[model samples]
Target: MHVIAERLIDDGVLEREFTLGEIPGVLWTPPSASASAPAPVILLGHPGGLNGMYPRLAGRARQCAANGFAAATIELPGSGDRPRSVDAEQARADLRRAVAAGEPVDGEIVDRLVLPLVEKAVPEWRTTLDALLSLPEIGGPVGYSGGVIAIGVRLALVEPRIAAAGLFAGSFVPRATFDEARQVTIPLHVLLQWDDEGNDRQMALDLFDAFGSEEKTLHANMGGHTGVPRFAGDDAARFFVRHLR
Candidate 1:
């Protein structure tokens, strides 16, 4: 919970970079946020590598801020400046090799690559939520939005503070995630790119179907992985507003 740097973005959004122990993260609060009128928060999740993901994370944070919610994201384990795992690295190489050879990725490889991440990162996110909500300007009823859907699913099931989630369906989802998805009861807005080259579209659809939330909406669009339309983001923001506000 240490503040390392701070700046004001356009439209008076406050951006702060900080570390919680060894985990580096960024937080953005809107102009209207304050102790007297604390803002609801959105935790932004991503596939590993915060430095490469910063621009998009900042863009999403700005959108959340504009909608009157504080947004924050933490670096995932074995990502960015964090220490790398030899096992995870090997699993990644195996996955890439399979993909490059136009072969189906083995389920074991997917488990090896993603399960440990979900196990480690979910607790980190809970800790981050604890720290973020402790800030005077960031309040409860949190929403989680982004990829690494496994992490989002785990949090939605286990973290009582998270009221809703807007999940991006462009990542590799392991088999065990489907079982977890069935236990998640929070409201969900899942976005899927039908033509995503790197993602298995049917898996995304099945995962969407597996979510046990009584209130869950799927937004499947015709596009590649990075081709999520601008309007989709607007729709996601509205989804958060519906729950977080």
Candidate 2:
């Protein structure tokens, strides 16, 4: 895998370093020029433990780019490019508050900071979608893949443009997450492993049951938390092409 640390922005689709208050993040985009045609766009959310550019995720992003899709992988507030550690009690308190409020809690405690970063991210992704649609080379569909951030599946369901999604060893926080996940109406493809440490098989089963969409497919592999070694990357690419396109 090739790693390059640089700010990225293309046309109206901007991929640059951004900060949500004190939290720093990286953004991505498609071409900016407007045209008659529109292409699909995907906003990728990375796994919790790994950085955005983890080998598996990097491979997936490259595959998306090679397959004529605009894919952007962004690091979560507390992970990669931005790291801050809090006491266990503080962390538990924040998690509790987020559970109570039904949203992501990032940053210092007591402030109850609920950044609308994902909400804001939707428009940025839409801008890239518009740019992609304008391009003559892309005439197919658009979608998203939560490389490890399966929680984004719930978010994608609320958005109108996300036609499909691919999630690998996804993490769904709090029990209420399944309730939000049930609202998803698009095709959702989940890849889970039996021995995975991050997410258990039962969670995947529950998510499968919670999904309201009739077009859901679940694949259980032999690998552990990371599904890469167990499942072939080519198979994943095929699955994306089969559903997203």
In terms of lDDT, the poorest run of 10 residues in model 1 is 132-141
TM-score to true structure, per model: 0.99, 0.63
TM-score, prediction 2: 0.63
Residue-level lDDT tens digits of model 1 in 101-153:
99998989999999999999999999999999899998988999998999999
Across 98-190, the per-residue lDDT of candidate 2 in tens digits comes to 757866444343222222333344454455545444545444466677643334654566657677877665443445556767888887777
lDDT of 1: 0.94
lDDT of 1 at 73: 94
In order, candidate lDDTs are 0.94, 0.54
Among these predictions, the greatest TM-score belongs to 1
